[model samples]
Target chain A: MNAIEVKDVSVYYGNLCAIRDVNLNVKEKEFLGIIGPNGAGKSTLLKVILGLIKPVSGEVRIFGKDLKETNKILGYIPQTSGFDRNFPINVLDVVLMGRLKNRLSLFHRYAKEDMEIVTDLLDKLGLSDVRDRQIGQLSGGQLQRVLIARALAIEPKIILLDEPTASIDANSRSQIYSLLKELNEEMTIVVVTHDLAAVSAYFDSIACLNKELHYHGDKELDEETVEKIYGCPVELIAHGVPHRVFKVHEEGYDD
Target chain B: MIEAFLQYVFLQRAVYSAVLASIVCGIIGTIIIEKKLVMMSGGIAHTSFGGIGMGFFLKIEPIIGALIFSVLTAIGITTVRRRTNTNSDTLIGIFWAMGMALGILFIAFTPGYPPDISSYLFGDILTVTELDLKIMIALTGLVIFVIVALFNYWKAYLFDEEFSSVIGIKTIFLEYFLFVLIALAIVALIRVVGIILVIALLTIPPAIAKLFTFDLKKMILYAIFLGIVFSFLGLWISYQFNIASGASIILLAGLTYIAAVIIKRS
Candidate 1:
């Protein structure tokens, strides 16, 4: 059964269509990468699925249930830009937020199990030492790991991340990909990213978006689809190897 | 100061006002700084002037007017912000100016001897009445109660609003609830520091506390303690120099923050 099913989804900002009539499906435990250029509605599509942004018209289902009913099953790692990094919250407290599902009592306390889950995730993400440090003090890579730990703390059936490795060192980038690759064995993963090199290496499936669903299927994308999604993108390289992504140019083509 | 507190009801009320103002300001001010809502809070503070003017025109207690105006402005700003494309700071500026304009108009139209509006614009803590004290007590209780009860959710919301909503935390409700709390906190401080200087009291203590701690609860406690100290020190300074109480408090807090910054860097 599909873990996520999005049907006829469209989002608009004013009259500008952000994403249009995009339909996609991800089976359980599948690793899906969404690739698109800037302003291509990649982030918008993720927000729609997370129910953070209401699509102009669409239906999103997780495990055959409505988006609202599937909150506990969805773990999201949003891009870190939208919030104050200097906020006075320690790493442990930030990760512990994932356990906030369905526990809305006044004066609620974190269960003992909640702490264990967060602690374990922190250790796995190599964030144990920075557990008590302020989020503002973390490097980009460390902050990304904290967000990953937070997402995992939900014990989600499906995890979604937006640009998870956007602003980190190359070494940390590979570490994160490997971590996600390990986690993929247990849960479905959907990532929106601009890292084409990592895309082919990590994602079992890929979706190309440009304000609409240009392509959605396996990792082997045709050159025509690539050009259509990026508008001007002509070349693609994967995994530090010179992989042919575009049609070979004619000898007389402009240099 | 101890003997004076026992002798005069007004002195007792002033001390009470100082402590009460510190409590709400410490709590809500930390949120204001953390959430980056300082300008919006200032806009709310300035807009309450219209309500104060309305109270004078209607012959009711001015703080009551200030409360109603601030709550409405908070709702207006939040709603319009969500539905419209107007830049938030621009919207805040509009509300800020409109509130002041309305206050000026209301005060001009009121007949009889012009009331001493300086106390509202620049708070006269020495003149805090029984009614003001009661209102401050109620608001302080509500602010503390709400914050403590929703502490868990608030941390999440402040850290990452979008992720919190995805986790089913009722973020919209939290957003509106927070704005209203800000309004209440502003009104609660109006009698102690007045409108113009209230922002300082609301912001400075928390800003100082932030330098010392990274934990939210510890930061709040430190802010409250700092707030009380600044208020008492300013109160003493004002009494000794025969100067404006509100101005003294704000100046002391401001200078202390600068000193703390310098010391930390050193």
Candidate 2:
């Protein structure tokens, strides 16, 4: 069964088209990486899947159901920049937010069992010691781990991350990627990232997107796809513009 | 001061209500600062002036009018914010001015001479009647009840609206509920600090407490303690010097905030 299916989807930010005619289908537990440059609708595609933004055309389905209907089975880790750094929220409270999906959430308190689950997930993520610490006190890597632990607290079947390691250090990026690689063993993983190297190394299926899907399949990034996505024929443009400008000035001076 | 509480009914009411307002301030203030909604609260407080004027013109208690007007403007701001591209600062500034203008117009049209409306702008905490105390107690209870009932959701919503909503939280409902609660908290503080100083009372204690602790519950506790102390000291100072009660309270809170900054730096 496919974990996520996007059919003929297009999105626009009012008048400007962001993503156009994109199609994707991920088999259950498939590791998918989407790569694109800035302003390339990479994050927009993920937001469409997360139901944060409705596509201007077409549909997104999760676990063969509408995205909203199957939301409880999905987990999300937004970029750490989404949070208020000054909130006095402790790690445990932040993690426990994942349990909000429980049916009998008595007075919005985390049940003892829910706490146990959070503790176990934190331990697995190597964040057990900082469970009581304030979330703001965490390093980039640690905060990302806490966010991942919170996502796991939902016991989701699929997890979506947007630039999970964007602001973190290189060592932390490796740690987070490895952790994600391990989690991919059981759950469907979809990540939107700008790191082309990570896509080449880790993703079973890589989709190169620049307003539209330039390449999609179980293949590493190729030179052509990279050029198509970035649209930077830099050497050709550099040779043309500077040479032409210099020639024009040289002739004018000689005259 | 202790004997004064036992000596006068008005004093007893002021003390009781001040404690309640401080607790509400502590709780709501922490959320406000963390959410970066301090300016929004100021917008709401200033707009409540329209409600006060409406009450006088309508021959009703000014607070009732303030409550209705403030909640509506708050909801209006939230709605316009959600739908339009207008910067929130501009939206809030418009409402802040409109509210004051409306208040002034209504007061000008009120028949015969009226009570000084500056009482709403610069509060007289010593004038808190027994009835005002009862209403404040009820409002405090309401604030506590809502916060306790929605603690986890509030945390999730405040932390990340996107993450919380994707997990099936009703974030829109929570935001509106919070706005209403903020309005009620503002109303409670009106009598204690008046509209002008209510934002200070709602913010300073939490700011001071946040510097000391990162735990939300602990922050609230420290804020409540600080708020109560500031209110008491302000009340004492005002009684001794016969100055404006609200100004004195806010001034004390302001001084403490400076001390906290100095302490942290040193």
Which model scores highest in lDDT?
1
How much DockQ does model 2 earn? 0.53
| Residue B211, candidate 2: alpha-carbon lDDT | 90
Q: Residue A59 CA error for candidate 1 (Å)?
A: 1.6
Cand 1, B chain, TM? 0.99
Report the lDDT tens digits of candidate 2 across residue range A4-40: 9999999987789999999999889989888777889
lDDT of 2 at A33: 88
Q: Is the docking of candidate 1 incorrect, acceptable, medium or high quality?
A: medium
Candidate 1 chain A: worst 10 consecutive residues by lDDT? Answer: A246-255
* Candidate 2's iRMSD: 2.2
Where in model 1 is the C-alpha error above 4 Å? A236-255
**DockQ by candidate, in order:** 0.74, 0.53
Assess the local accuracy of residue B82 in candidate 2 as a C-alpha lDDT between 0 and 100.
89
Residue A48's C-alpha lDDT in candidate 1? Answer: 90
